[model samples]
Each structure stands twice: as C-alpha cells, then as structure tokens.
Target: MSEQSADPAADLSDDVRLPKEQPTPAFFESKTFRLISLVLYLGGISGLGMVLALYYLIFFDSGMPDIHLKFPVSIGGQPVQKVHEYQ
Candidate 1:
C-alpha cells in the first residue's frame, strides 16, 4: 500500500479549493425557475394596471372609447315619450 501524508492538506489538488457539499442542479431547473419568475412579475404588473384603471373610472369620469355593454337592449324596444294632454 502507498503511504499517505499525515497532513490533511496533502490530499488536496494543486488548486486547493474547498470541496462543495451540496449537489449542483441541472441548467434546465434554473431556466424553469426564471420562466416562473417572469410570469409572476408580468401577472403582478397586469393586476396593478387593472386596479388603477378601475379606480380612475369610478372616482373620475368616463368616455374612454366605449368598453361596451353599458346598457343592454330594452325589452320594450324603442323608447316613446308619454304625451301629457292637460286642457
């Protein structure tokens, strides 16, 4: 059997870096994490946009290029003004 040096540092390579304990994950795991992060970031931005828009619409004025369906078709159809005949 070959004799090893009594000193622990003697076993180390020339670089002499500390051995990493944790196992490194694959590259795809990192990419998946990044994609999930991006989606959450964009979702938060869109949610904020919707809240501000509605707040402005409520407290402020209207006429913002017709969101549509403000009023549905009346069941009675065309509106007719009642004529008052008082003699």
Candidate 2:
C-alpha cells in the first residue's frame, strides 16, 4: 500500500460556503404597514359593533310589538272552559 501526503489546501476545499443574510424589506418597516394594521383593527371593531347592535334591536328593544295567539272558545267537540283549571 502507498502512503498519501496530507495537504492544507485539500482541507480548505472541503469547507461549506453560506450566503450572507439581507436586511428586512423597506415596506415592512414603513408607516404603510402601520396604517393598514390600524384600518383592519378598526374595521373589525366596527363589524362587531354592528352585530351587537342588530342583536340588541332584535331581542331587547322595547319598540317591537308583543304578539300572543289565543285559541278559539272551543277545541274539537269540547268547550275550552271544560279544560282543567288551576285551583
């Protein structure tokens, strides 16, 4: 078997190369992103407000009329008065 010689250049050639990292984009660091975020937040709050207002109007508002259905004086062949009454 023949002996091989160790070379420093051969060891350096085996090293890995990595790309340099770049700074963040200008848009992400600009006021435009802040404005957009604010608009979205306000819009969400307004939407929730609208939903709550609609729910209150439908179920809790006093302006709505109260409706009750009363059956006729008699049902089938029996008079409704014959029905059981609480003491």
Candidate 3:
C-alpha cells in the first residue's frame, strides 16, 4: 500500500495552495473615475461663476448721483490749494 491517505479530505490539506480570483471594480467605483469626476465638477462651478461675474460687470450699472457735487473740495473753510502743511 502507498503512504498517501485513502480519505478524500486528505487531498485538500494545508500543504496545498489555491488560486484566488480578484474582484473586478465597476467604472464609477474606480479611483480614476472619481478623480476625473471631481475635476469636472470643480471646473464647471468655477466656469459658471466666472461667466456670471462677467455678465454682471458688462450689463449691470449703478445709478449716478442725483445731485451734482462740487470739485476742489475745501475742508474747514481752508482752501484745498492753500493747505501746504503736507508739503
């Protein structure tokens, strides 16, 4: 008789090595896909903000002052030209 065991369970002993199947990831679950999505999302938001800001600057305007203001403003009855203390 051979030295091997006659039992079926003996064939699957600790000495035997097994092959494992690696799990495949879905497209949305992948790291590359998540990074790409984050880039696109941020880019879209910034682009929209820039476009809105441009539109507001080009189209909207603040109303002009109702009363005319005098130029060469004088402070405390002192003429603006005569004030040479800063010089």
Candidate 4:
C-alpha cells in the first residue's frame, strides 16, 4: 500500500553483507604513488653514486706515479747533482 513495494529486504541485505574496506581502485594504486616512489629511488641511487665517486677520487685515484724517483742520479758514468728522475 506504500509506493506499491512488496519486498524491501533485498536492498537492505546487499548493504549489510559487505565489509567496510578500501575500494578496489584506490589511491594506493594510483600513478602518483608510483611517481613518488620512482623519484625517491632515483634520488637514493644518485646519492650513493656521488658518495662512491668522492671516495674513489680521494683514496683510489691519488696522483702517485707507478715508478719510483731516484735522487742523485748518474750521468755519463759520473754522479750528477741531486736530481729526482723516474726510475
């Protein structure tokens, strides 16, 4: 007699049976999060590269020659002045 509806329990049951969870297509699955993660990852990688570069430049790539320098070198079978030349 009220709006000619004989069954209203069907609509009520649909709403009550579902849990209050996040939607399937949510913000976590959006492109914004992916972009931010990529940016942070690249930044960390670049930072590590910079640190390694500085370390190598300071310790490994020193300006030292492979050969040694001998002082008071000899020339023409005679001892010359104290000169440092690579041996």
Cα lDDT listed for each candidate: 0.70, 0.69, 0.73, 0.72
The best candidate in terms of lDDT: 3
Model 1 residue 70 distance off true place after TM-score fit, in angstroms: 37
lDDT per residue for candidate 1 within 42-80, as digits (tens), equals: 999999999999999888766564322443334477424
* Model 1 residue 65 distance off true place after TM-score fit, in angstroms: 25
Sorted on TM-score, highest at the top, how do the candidates line up? Answer: 3, 4, 1, 2
TM-score of candidate 2 on Cα atoms, chains taken together? 0.38
Q: Where does the lowest 10-residue lDDT sum fall in candidate 2?
A: 64-73
Candidate 3: 10-residue stretch with minimal lDDT: 64-73
Q: What tens-digit string does per-residue lDDT give for candidate 3 at 1-87?
A: 768878878778565444454456798999999999999999999999999999889987867653324333577976565333322
Residue 12 in model 1: shift from native, Å?
2.8
Candidate 2 clashing pairs, residues 3+ apart or interchain: none
Off by over 4 Å in 3: 1-20, 64-87
Report the C-alpha displacement of residue 44, candidate 1, in angstroms. 0.4
Per-residue lDDT for 4-61 in model 4, tens only?
4577774464544345564556767889988989999999999999999999988886
